[model samples]
Target: MYSRALRPCLITFQVHGRHFSSTKQNNRRVTVIGAAGGIGQPLSLLLKQSDAITNLNLYDIVKHTPGVACDISHMNFPAKVTGFTGPDQLKDALRDAEVVIIPAGVPRKPGMTRDDLFNTNASVVRDVALAAAEVCPKALVGIITNPVNSCVPIYCEVMKKAGKLDPNRIFGISTLDLVRASAFIGQAKGLNPKTVNCPVVGGHSGVTIVPLISQCQPAVSFPQPELEKLTKRIQEAGTEVVQAKAGAGSATLSMAFAGARFAFALIRALNGESNVIECAYVMSDVQGTKYFASPLLIGRNGIEKNLGLGKLSDYEQQLVKAAIPELKANVATGEKFVK
Candidate 1:
């Protein structure tokens, strides 16, 4: 996992039920599993800064979870931090959570495909999902675990078995894909990355990730060759980071930032903000795929509406067609995990 301790140089007001944001009045409980890992630690730190989180639970199989919680508790945020370790504490961690973000699982190593992580991560997600189903079935579950194409279905199937499946309440954190797509596209077009919005659809794996650069928010133009190349870059960006790490680990920092972005957006929506939107991989009939990533309007009850893939150019359409078979295989692989 991607856990290097970046300096905590954040600024805010004095603590004890006080925060800098005027809109920080929501008293929602947020739980993070895998709080000791690379992505988990930074993600926990980032979540600690959120005004929407009144209670933040950090749970991990690792014994150091409490230590991580203790570290984050000293921050100048209103959210009270608590740590829960191992299966014994999982129920407590999830007891009343309104949002659960699972980043638990092994990270990809050099030369390892996301599918190579299937067996290990599938079980991790299954256990977590079952726990969520048991204790907080209505929590907005955003999955940050890998092999997401497979893991999300595994989580959903477990919920389904428990008779607690709410397709709208479960989501795969495909925010990283959209984040990368927007940044890369913005860089290509000399636009502000923060202002760029690119809808990345399809699943969360290699070939399954489809970045619709043609539908970018600013309505920019790209030549066919450039578009094709940029799309490929976005699809393979995860692997690109993994390889660049040279066996250290996968893309933890960027993934944490993207995960936090998605979590905050969901929290805002849950807190009654209107028009909150983000791209997520979720169960969908969109494009006939059992699960697909698309832009979703998040509301009080999770996904208000799935804004299906808008308009794909001929090349984008070709990408979707090419991805279907592989995506179906991934879905089957996940659905088979419990059965």
Candidate 2:
């Protein structure tokens, strides 16, 4: 379940045009790669429930996607579901899609870092991203693939090579970190988690994930020791989930929820709504890093504006400084993999 503040209900807008038939005329066509995976299934389910989505396409290397699609189609939601399996069907799945989300990759194990999952996942993301480029070049692409710090650049590289790269439309989903920051801080202060909005920036791995708790909305303060402890815990939350699952899985459900939340924000933006904002990792110029996560204003094009990291406390500034090297190395590894 998501906090009310975190999950807004779907909004429908009236439409007028000789070319349009129903309210669904303007809704988006969304495609999900790796739709049978732990994260993809729930994310698809959430998107299926949204009134803003008119058609949902599911694709995966695994053959189970049809069964997942068949099951989800039984739901009464307005979004029609279709499943595509294997590389042969990839183009069909991506065709006409306005929004494409990739969460396909191997899950992380207890002792492994995100960088460790890069070998298998990088190719997975690259192939899928390339397919999107060939078939749905204008789609707003949201990548939830592991080792996002690297995979995002890998995707960008592929898109660039194809000459279909729309810098504004490519995004790395880092909302899970923001979700964790708000939840943890709210718990610590006995405030409503739903009311807590924490802006998380930097990159999407280990120490690179920076939670700007100092800029939390409805401002609150923490002792220096507690602040340091909370920051570390937020940074390592993914590992904590991996260890807690005893190697059976990574953070699937919560991640699905977070991915859905970001995707919906995109859908709203595409619907011509204004003032929608969320935190995302994208090709950025913040702090001279090649790609950074910052508060982004989402609109019909994708990232309407990059709200650079607002003022950071000395400690938070140090966190950003420490993240740049690792972030750069990860990004280079991805770019190299593409070449």
**All candidates: TM-score:** 0.93, 0.93
Instruction: Give candidate 1's TM-score.
Output: 0.93
- lDDT, each prediction: 0.85, 0.85
Task: Residues 1-339, candidate 1: write the lDDT tens digits.
Answer: 001110111123223544433354568899999989989999998889877789999999999899999999999877999999999899899998999999999999999999999899999999998888889999999999989999999999999999999999999999898789878988998987776777788989888999887777667887788878888899999989999999999999999888887788778778786667777899999978799988788888998888788767888899999889998999999999988
Model 2 agreement with the true structure over 1-339: per-residue lDDT tens digits: 112222332222122222111224347899999899999999888777776688999999898899999999997777899999999999999998999988899999989999889999999999988888888998998999989999999999999999998889999999999889988998999988777888889888988999998888758899999999999999999999999999999999989888887887787788876667888899999877789998888888898788788778899999999999999998899999999
RMSD of each candidate relative to the true structure: 5.9, 5.1
Off by over 4 Å in 2: 1-26
**Candidate 1, residue 61: how far the Cα is off, in Å:** 0.6
Per-model tally of clashing residue pairs: 2, 0
Colliding pairs, model 2: none
| Residue 72 Cα positional deviation in candidate 2, in Å, after optimal superposition | 0.5
Q: Positional deviation of 57 in candidate 1, in angstroms?
A: 0.1
